[model samples]
Target: MIVYEVFRQERKGQAFAHAGSVGAPDAAFAEAYAREQYGRRGESVALWVVPREAVAEIHEFVDELQKNYHRVDGYPLKEKLKEARERAGTAPPADR
Candidate 1:
């Protein structure tokens, strides 16, 4: 038996998400099984039954180098905003 991935669109104009998987002998069987499992209630607008072998899996997601600039803490927006306000002669009045 071949494993298949099932993707379903809940409604028109919406993105499709992974619904589940089905094990079958071929594409025809996979499609029928996916339809029966996910679309029997008429809730799915569309379905895509793709073989597991056709899908690519990513196993490694490690970032070898540390890049602090990619995070929010690396952005010093307050200082930049203060400089811009100063340059525009719109600095907030000195606190009383």
Candidate 2:
């Protein structure tokens, strides 16, 4: 395989994300190198290493077409907040 996958966790109960990639001959060497390359400073709480051939990769995620309706910006609140503040007679404290 042309690439090796490496993942690292920030701390206990945290998620693991892609840290980097390296080249190696076997799983033993790849795991050793990946640990050193990504967790040398004792920064990672855990790791996962896999060969490129054994791992599946996809770059064409559909984040572009899929709207994030659960995101903070997805909730329209500017007009509602302005009206609420006006109703409460608390007009957004003067800008500094």
Choose the strongest candidate by TM-score.
Answer: 1
Per-residue alpha-carbon lDDT of candidate 2 for residues 16-57, written as tens digits (9 for 90 to 100): 998989898878888888888998899998998877678877
Off by over 4 Å in 1: 59-76, 93-96
List per-candidate RMSD values in Å: 3.1, 4.1
Candidate 1 C-alpha lDDT tens digits along 3-56: 999999999989999998999999999999998999999989999899999999
Go through the candidates in order and give the clash count of each. Answer: 0, 0
Q: Give the TM-score of candidate 2.
A: 0.57
Residue 6 of model 2, lDDT score: 87
State how far residue 95 of model 2 sits from its true place (Å): 24
* lDDT of model number 2: 0.84
What does candidate 1 score on TM? 0.76
In model 2, which runs have C-alpha deviations exceeding 4 angstroms? 59-96
Give residue 20's lDDT in candidate 1 (0 to 100): 87
